[model samples]
Target: YDPKRTRFRNQHRGRMKGKSYRGNRICFGRYALQVLEPAWITARQIE
Candidate 1:
């Protein structure tokens, strides 16, 4: 994932800049899955 893009989203859409969203692990995990699954799958597929 692009650090710049993540930073932008965290700052703008995520509303999580410089603040502790640590209690929201489920939300963060879901967001991470949504962001990373495509690349992760493409890299691991056996076909």
Candidate 2:
């Protein structure tokens, strides 16, 4: 979906340089999907 107000600074490229400490472990399900690398999820791929 398109945003209402488009800013110049908000159109910058994304970087996966840092480490995430939060949500490293599963808290709900017995089998869960964890991502080792960064990726983009399209709306069509959700189904």
Candidate 3:
């Protein structure tokens, strides 16, 4: 997790961005989740 007030550079954010193999959330207040790969039976996130 990161501090909401902390700033991130474009390069730093790009490096931290998640790939398709791992689940990630899209930006812009979409409130959506992305799961492109297989995961364990109980591994999940709820928001």
RMSD values, in order shown: 13.4, 4.2, 12.8
lDDT winner, 2 or 3: 2
- For candidate 3, lDDT tens digit of each residue in 1-47? 76556465443422333345533546578587655654433445441
* Superposition TM-score, candidate 2 onto the true structure: 0.44
Best-to-worst ranking by lDDT: 2, 3, 1
Instruction: Report the C-alpha lDDT of model 2 over 1-47, residue by residue, as the tens digit.
Output: 87777666466567765445697788887987766777666899867
2 against 3, candidate with superior TM-score: 2
Evaluated at residue 36, the lDDT of candidate 1 is: 22
- The model with the greatest TM-score is 2
The collision pairs in model 1 are none
Worst 10 residues of 1 by lDDT: 32-41
Q: Which stretches of candidate 2 lie above 4 Å from their native place?
A: 1-10, 42-47
Index of the highest-lDDT prediction: 2
User: In candidate 3, which residue pairs clash?
Assistant: none
- lDDT of all the models against the reference? 0.39, 0.71, 0.49
Residue 28 displacement (Å), model 2: 1.7
